[model samples]
Target: MSRRGWVLFLAMSVIWGIPYLLIKVAVDEVSPETLVFLRCLIGAALLLPWTIARGQLRPVLRHWKALLLFTVLEMAGPWFLIAYAEQTLSSSLTGLLVAGVPFVAALAALLLGEEERLTPVRLLGMAIGVVGIGVLLGLDVDGAQLLPLLAIGLVLVGYATGPLVVTRALPDVPGTAASSIALFVTAVVYTPFALPQLDGTGQVSAPAWWSLAALGVLCTAIGLALFFALIREVGPQRALVITFVNPAVAVLLGVWLLGEPFTLGIALGLPLVLVGCVLATRRSPARTEPSELADVDSAVP
Candidate 1:
């Protein structure tokens, strides 16, 4: 990676890493649906001008179907689910659950007949990753509730679908344009539910509002821009490496900022899940091309 790539990579890791904490803060006072709506609305408002300046808005509007699917799958659904889950689950636990996204994406690729082939080594890696997750869950199981686990599962499913959606449905569209359109559509879709919650008393605190602003401007807008740049530069498979780093950030933030407990289970389970991800998605010597989307879609709460 070049200097720019490294910059984008680190920026994405940190920006994305903070969103779980931010969501935790915002959702303390706001509804999940409302948070999703605000995130999309603010993110879209920030990006809309750029889309217009680049003359990409018209093209995005033209590809409304792809935009809609990407919005629902990538943005609205997962965002709400993560927020809902975080009410019960810690940010670290949510991040750990999301670590499985690449494996899910790889499985989707194999099932969908994409370029990647699942070798035995990859299979073993996947198994190890699963075991690691199991270990983590066993350790954290006492702290985790059932509904939160279910929500985390939904987040994993949504995260997994993101790459497939980008590669298969919206491949021709530039990621920035695609993401911008998706955010815009997500804002529109979330309006009905979000509107009802936007009353005066429902307003969030200053810090929470700042967190949402960061979620939109820094996390969603800038993070997605850097993520797309990374995919274009390093390819998606390598870019997915950010997932490994994101969990650590989430765990740290959860413990340090949110006062969520950091247990031996998380300490042990985190590496296992990350290692499993490495094994499952590691590029073989013969493999050349990188994935286009970089699988950063695991921005679950």
Candidate 2:
């Protein structure tokens, strides 16, 4: 990677990582639906014009079915669940849990007929990742955290499913257009629910508002652009390293800024899940990494 690639890499690390903290803040005063809606609205407003100016916005509409599926799985469902989970789970924990996305994606790929074999190493990785989940669940098994953990599981599934939707359905859609359209549609879908929640917006604090702005502009819109740019600069394999780095930044920001608890379970489970994800998603020595990794935008909250 060049100096510029390093800059984009680090910048995107912070950009994607901060959303966990921001969502934690925003969801305190705003409902999850409203928070997602507002963020998407702002993100669409920011990105759609640029997409249209580039004449890439129209192709996004041609694959409306897939775009809708992508919106539901990627932007709408995961964002809402993450917001809801952050209501109970620490921002740090939420980030750690989400780090399992690549593992989930690997399983999804196999299940969806991608021709990767479930080798011994990959199976062991999957087992380790599952054990990590067990460790996370064991920590709060008797507590009210089970439902939130389930919610995180759903978010992971949704995140995992999103890339396949893009690869199979919207392969030719421009990244900006796909992001902008998906967000716009999600915003529209949540508008009725979100509108009522806006009644209490006056009571929301500046931190929350700023957090929402950052979530929309920095996390959703610019994050997509930089993610694509990172792939273009350093190739998709290296760009995928952002997924590994994001959780650490998220955990750090949560502990340092939000004062979130870093429990024993998270300490033990985080590395297990991360290492598992690396193994499960890694290409074999004889295999080439997929070029479609560049085609699909898998930026997370």
User: Any residue pairs clashing in model 1, and if so which?
Assistant: 236-291
Off by over 4 Å in 2: 140-142, 285-299
State the C-alpha lDDT per candidate.
Answer: 0.78, 0.82
lDDT of 1 by residue, 1-301 (tens): 8888888788878887888889888888888888899898888887777888999878767767766776776787888989998887788888777787877767877788864678888998899888888987887876548887877787777767766666666656667877777888888988999898889534568988888888888999888878878888776655777877888888899899989998888889888888888888766687666345433434433
Expressed as tens digits, the lDDT of each residue in 1-301 for candidate 2 is 7999999899988898889999999899899999999999999998889889988877668889988998898889999999999898889888888888887888888888964788888888888988886797787344788788889999989988888887787766666678888889999999999998788899999999999999998998898888777777887677777787788888889989988777788788878877887776666678654453333334568
Task: Give each model a TM-score.
Answer: 0.92, 0.94
Local lDDT at 279 for model 2: 71
Error of 1 at 69 (Å): 1.7
Best by lDDT: 2
Best candidate, TM-score = 2
- Least accurate stretch of 10 residues (summed lDDT) in model 2? 289-298
